[model samples]
Target: MGEFEFLAKLRERLPPDGPQVKLGSGDDAAVTAPAGATATSVDAIVEGVHFRRGEAELRTVGRKALATALSDLAAMGAEAGEAYVVLGAPADLGEEDFLALLDGMLELAAETGTTIAGGDVTRAPALTLAVTVVGHAAAADAFVTRAGAQPGDLLVLTGEIGAAAAGRLLLEHPALAAELPESTARELRRRQLDPMPRLRTGLALAGSGATAMIDLSDGLAADAGHLARAGGVALQIQADSLPLAAGVAEVAAAAGRDPIELAVAGGEDYELLAALPPDRLVPASDASGEAGEAKLTPIGEVVVGEGVEIRLPRGGQLKAAGFDHFAGPERGSQPEARERRGG
Candidate 1:
């Protein structure tokens, strides 16, 4: 179908605008009335660099594009609000493909009470999606930041890590699926293709006195470094304490890699990692449990130092490296100097 025709279909499929949105799509700009504070983030995924369209359904891709972008809002402990999307369609796309993708995104928007306020479509060399999400909070201080971690604060993590990375490995090397149960392999693939943002848990942590927070899109090792750099502190993570998904070890072993390294260096888990006061640990865990979100686990602590140090249970330290967006297929680590400092 043509661009205008697809847009008309999108408008027809969208649900009623949320309370925060004054005007929805089909305008030059979307109008929104913020209650108090707002946190905005933008993220994009490209076909080859982010995903191989051949391996995933268009619907799943749509969900992932929006979910990944909203993860930023979750990290800030903000309530999801509105989303603006930009879809770049390749020449081979058809009407059914477009609607299927929109249906996926609309489903997620409804689930999160987010309004699809505005967007644009264009021809591109590859299938591309860019999503911009705005999240709301009572005040600026209500939203946690990476820069707010304090010395002696306890580091907490939501859900488990390495599943998405393992999922990617499975997708890229289908032969490795023989190493895991069928269900486990499918779940791992789902983890990579359709990650959910930790919205409720983020709000719970924010309410429970979390001082600093970030989502694990770029693996624990790299993102922990980001938090440490932002807060000007050190993150001492116990390797044994990391919560690994059930099939991560199997997949890692089959792939001839360390499960801990996969958990540390793998990206796209989309779970929340936060720094909370010692006294707030129980409250935070309870809050997350009451919300029926992922289990909260204490994996480390913040100290008065500069880099991130992931201590292995046996000995030595884990050299963590996360996904590099611009680094082609052979993604490398950050500079030695910055990595040494844990940034």
Candidate 2:
């Protein structure tokens, strides 16, 4: 389909616009009003790097593009407002496939109460979608920042981690996943392809006195370091306490890798990790979060020192690392660095 035809289908799936969106899709430019504080975030997905062109389903790709961009809004504890997707697609891409892809994004957009506004559509060597989301806060202090964490604050994580990375590994080498149970494979793939943004949990934490917050886009340990450096506090993550997702351990074992290591280094979980006062330990949605279940849990504590440390249950420290785009490899202290620190 042509650009205009594709956008028309996308607009149909979008949630009905509120007062904030004076104009929806199909305009020279979209207009919006800020009822309160607003958070705007832009994210893009490139072919090969973000998704496999022909191998990955188009709908799944669409959902991921929008889901990833909205995750930033969730991190800020903001409610959905409206969105615009700039498409860099090839001319050879058929209308049906493109529409299907956009429909995927619209489904998630409706789920999050966001409408698709407007954006540019142009030709590119490969398919790419850049999404911009605008979100609004409900009340004062409803927006959380990384700098809000305190030395005494406890670090709480929302939802599961590691499954996405395992899924990625399996996708790269399906032979590895073939050894695992079918259900395990499906769950792991879902983690990578259909990650849900922590919207409700983020809002809940923002209202409940979460000191600092960041979405886990770059794996646990990497993002933990981000929160630590931003808040000027050290984080001590208990390796045993993490809420590892279902199939993560099984998949890790199949790949001859450590489950905890995967949980720490696997990126793209799209979960939220926040520093909270000791009292606000659990969000209402995850109030019944039980052991061996993927739910909110307190995995660490904020400390006065610098850098991050994973307190292994077995008694040794694993210097934490995560994906860094420019750095090639994630920067972290080797085990020897732990001894240097007098561990």
Top TM-score prediction, candidate number: 1
Worst 10 residues of 1 by lDDT: 334-343
Which candidate leads in lDDT?
A: 1
In candidate 2, which residue pairs clash?
1-95
lDDT of 1 at 221: 83
User: Alpha-carbon error at 336 in model 2, in Å?
Assistant: 21
lDDT per residue, candidate 1, 60-104, as tens digits?
Answer: 888988999999999999999999999999999999899888999
Candidate 1 segments whose C-alpha is farther than 4 A from its true place: 328-343
Q: Give the TM-score of candidate 1.
A: 0.95
Clashes of each: 0, 1
User: What TM-score would each prediction reach against the true structure?
Assistant: 0.95, 0.90
Count backbone clashes in candidate 2: 1
Query: What local lDDT does model 2 show for residue 253?
Result: 89
- RMSD, every candidate, angstroms: 3.4, 5.1
Worst 10 residues of 2 by lDDT: 334-343
